[model samples]
Target: MEPEMLQRKIIHVDMDAFYASVEQMDNPLLKGKPIAVGGSEARGVVSAASYEARKFGVRSAMSGYMARKLCPELIFVRPRFDRYKEISNKIRKIFHEYTDLVEPLSLDEAYLDVTENKKGNPSATLIAQEIRKRIFEEVGLTASAGISVNKFVAKIASDYNKPNGQKTVNPDEVEAFMEGLDVKKFYGVGKVTAERMYQLGIFTGADLKSKSIEYLEQHFGNSGRSFYNLSRGISYSKVKPNRTLKSVGAERTFNVNLSSEIFMEERLENIAKELERRLQKSKIAGKTVTLKIKYSDFTLQTRSKTLPYFIADKSLIFEAAKELLYQEKMKESVRLLGISLHNLNTEMKKSVVVQLKFDF
Candidate 1:
C-alpha cells in the first residue's frame, strides 16, 4: 500500500452508557450509583446500564428482571429516549464546530475524520483528547475516543480505554496492535462468528492470518476475504458526513400572555400537529422531543426527551410533548409553543459494523 494513501487520521468517539449516564448527569442524586434506564419493573428490559451497574454484569438489552437479580442495589429509571436525542443533537452541534466530516453511528457513537480538519491542527490525537475534554466540560458527559490512521483502528482504539478514556495508535504500531487482538474483537466477528472461529482454532489475528484465502473461504465462505484483510489492520472506507437536516420547526410569539387553558391547548395542538406532519412526510421517527416555549415577558425555555425507539405516531408525540410542557411548570403565561424532533438519523438501523475491511 502507498504510504500517502494511508496517511489520513480518523477518530471514533463513543459516549459512555449514553442514556443512563445522561440521567445521572442531570440529577446529582443518581451519580455513581448502579443505574439502568428503561423498564423499572421486573418485566422491563435495560436500555442502557451505567458503568456502576455494568460492574454487576448488567448490560443493555438484558431483561430488567435479570439486571436486578444480578445486582440487588441496582436502580432502574424509566428510559427517556427523547432526552437522549436532545443531548445527542447538542453533541452533534459540538462536532460540527470542529469538522463537518462526522459520521454518527448511533446517538452515542460517531466517526470523525480529522486528517484535514477545519482547525488546521496537525495532531489527530490532540484533537481527540480536546474533543473528549470539551464534551465533559460543555455537556456534562464523558466520552471515550480512539485515534488511528483509519476508521477500523480508531474504532478499536476507542474501546481499548473505555468509559471516559482515550487511546491512539501510531502508524508504525498498527501491525503489532492488530496482530495481538483476539479474533472475537475483529470488526465483524460477533458471538456466533467468534464461536465458529474458536471451533476452527482461530483464536487471534496470527491464527486468522495463518490460513490461506482459499482454505479460509472453504471454511468461512465469502467472509474469508474480509478476515484476511482485517487481520492486517487495513481500512479504506471514508467518513460519511451527517449533513441532512430532516425536520424543521418554528414558533411565534404574542405580546399578551396566554392564560386560557383552552387557547393554549389549541395552540399546542396546532404546532404539534404541524411538527408531526413534517416528521411523517420526512420518514423521520424520533424518540427525542423538544418543546420550545416563550414566556409572556418574551423569555424562553426548552425541554426535550428521547424515547426507546423511533415513533411517528402523532398522539404519542404530543403526549410526551404535553408532558414536557407541563413538567416545565408554565411559570410565565406561555405566549408561544413549538416542538421539534432531532433524532432523524436514527434511521440508519442496520448494524454499522460493516467489517471495515477491504476484501482483497
Candidate 2:
C-alpha cells in the first residue's frame, strides 16, 4: 500500500455581498433594503445584489429589467469600483497579518495556506475564526470562512454557513464529506457539466467515484483526471502569493444594436484603445488577439489570432481585431463588442510542489 500524504491547513475566506454591503455601510439609510450595484436601464446588468435583493431573485450578471421585474422595490445604484478597491485593500492587509501565503481570487474572495503561518497558531479553524472577527471589527464587514486540509474542500465548505459564519472539515472527515456532496457543488462543475454527469448516472461524488478512470477520461477528456481525484478528496493545487495575469481585455455593451460593419469597426477601435491602456498600465503584452461578439439574439461568438510576437500598441491591436471582424460575415445585429489579448508575457509558471509536515 502507498504511504499516506501529510495534511496541509488551508482556509478560504469570502466576503458577503461585498459591493452591496459597502454601499449599505457607507449610507446607513439603505441598510436592510434590496439594492443592486449597476445601472437600472433596459440594457443594464446587475453587478451585485444585496442579500435582501437576492431573496427576490435578483442576482449578478442578470438583466436590470429582469431584476426590477422580480423585485419591484429593487433600488439600482451605480457601482463605485474605487471605493470597493479601497475596502478590499484593507481586508487584504488584515489577511497578511496572520499569513503571507494569502492568494486573492478577486476583490472579495481568497485562499490562504496556514500550514506554517506567522502567528504560529496550529489550528486553522481558530485562525479562520480570528480572521473573520478581525474583518468585522476592523473593516466593518462580515466575512465567512472555511478551514480544511486542501483548497478544493475549503472553498466548498466556505459556502456552507455563509453571511458571517465559518465551518471546518477535519482531516478525517474529508472523504465522507466529498462523497455526500452534490456534483454541482464541486468547484468548476457548471450547470451544463452537472446535467451531462446526471445523464451518465453520476449525480453525486459517490456516483463519480464508482466510474473508472478510463470511462471518465473518454467522456470528460482532460477534466476527467481532475474529477477522478477530486471525488476522492485529493487535490494538489497550492496557494500562490503572486498569481500572474493571464489576459488583458475591455468590452462595451451598446445601448443600440448596430448591423453595419462601419459601426462595429468604430467600436472595436475604441475597445482596442482601452485594452491597450490596460496592457500598458501593467506593462504587459500578449501574442494572441481575440474578438468577442454578442448578437442581438444573445448568441455569442469569439474569433482569435496568434501572432509570432507580442504586441501592446492600440494601432496593432485594432488592426488585428479588424482582420478578425471581417474574417466572417455578420450573423445578426451586434449588441456587444470586446477585444482581449492573451498568451501574456507574465503567464504563471508551474507551481513547485512542497511537502507540508504538521506535528498535530
Candidate 3:
C-alpha cells in the first residue's frame, strides 16, 4: 500500500431510509409503521421502504405487489421528489461547512474527504459524529456514517451499524476487516457477480484476495482490477467535489399504456423538454440522444442516435429523439417514455484540457 493512501481520511454519510423516514417525520401517524414510498400496488415499484418494512423482506426496487405480499400492512405513499431535493440541498449545505471535498453519490448519500478540513479536525471519526449530529438536529432525520482511510472501506463501514449509527475502521485493522467480509458485501459485487464468484469458489474477501489479478481480469474483464484492489483495501479514487456529469435524462411512466404513435410523440416531446431543461441547468450538452420505451408487459427497448455536434436545445434534442422513435417499430403499447443525452461536452473539454497540458 502507498504511504499517501494511508494518509487520506474519508467518510461516507448515508441517510437512513431517507424517503420513508421523511414521510414518517412529516406525519407522526406513520411512525413505527411499515411504509413504502412509490406508486400504487397495481402498476408500481417500491422506491424506498422503511426499516419496519425491510424486516418483512420489502426493499427498494421491489414490485409494490410483492412488497405488500411480504408485509401486508405496508402503507404506500407517492414519491415527493421536490421535497426530497429541498432536504438534500439542506444536507449538502451542512457537508460544505466541514469540507469542500464532498462527493454526492445521490440525494441521500455522499463521501467526504476531511484530511485537511475547514475546521482543522484531526479526528475523522469525531467529524463524522458531528456531521451526523447536525443532520439529525437540523433536518429532523437520522444518518449513518463510516470513517476510514479510503472511500471504499468507509462506504462499507457506513452500512455496518446503520440507521443513526457510526462505524470507524482504523488503518491497522483494514486488511483483517476486509478479509472477514462476505463477498456479497463488497462494493460493486452485486447478486449476479456474487453468484459467479461463488461458482468460482470465492465466497469472501480472503478468497478474492487469493486469486491472481490476471485470473480475475480473465474472468471479470476491466472490473477485475477494481475487485483486486478493493479486496486488498486499496482505492486511490479521490472525493471529487465537482464530479463530471456523464448523462442527462428524464422519463415518465403513464397511468395507461398508449398505443397511438401520436400520443407517443407527445410524450417524447415532454421527456425531451425535461432532458433539455436538466442539461441547461447543468450547463452541459451532449452528442448522443437515446429514446427509451417501456411496454405494459415490463419489456424495455431503446433506440439512440449520435449527432455530429453537442446539443442542449429542446428542439434539437426532440428532433433527434423523434428520429430514433420512428427508426424502430413498436412491439407493444408503451407504459413509459424517456429521453437521455450522453457523451457530454464537459467530458470532451476535460479531455482537451488534459491533452493541452501534455503537449505543453
Q: What lDDT does candidate 1 reach at residue 93?
A: 84
Better of 1 and 3 by lDDT: 3
**Model 1 Cα lDDT, one tens digit per residue, 119-233:** 8777888888888888889999999999887789889999988888999888878878888999999888999999999998999998988889898889889988889888877
Per-candidate count of clashing residue pairs (backbone under 3 Å): 10, 0, 0
For candidate 2, what is the lDDT? 0.91
* Model 3: how far residue 152 lies from native, Å: 0.6
lDDT of each: 0.80, 0.91, 0.88
Best by TM-score: 2
Over 4 Å off, model 1: 1-3, 243-360
lDDT of 2 at 347: 56
Total backbone clashes of model 2? 0
Q: What C-alpha lDDT, on a 0 to 100 scale, does residue 315 get in candidate 3? A: 94
lDDT of 1: 0.80
Clashing pairs in 1: 80-306, 81-306, 81-307, 82-288, 82-305, 82-306, 82-307, 83-305, 83-306, 287-307
Q: lDDT: which candidate is best?
A: 2
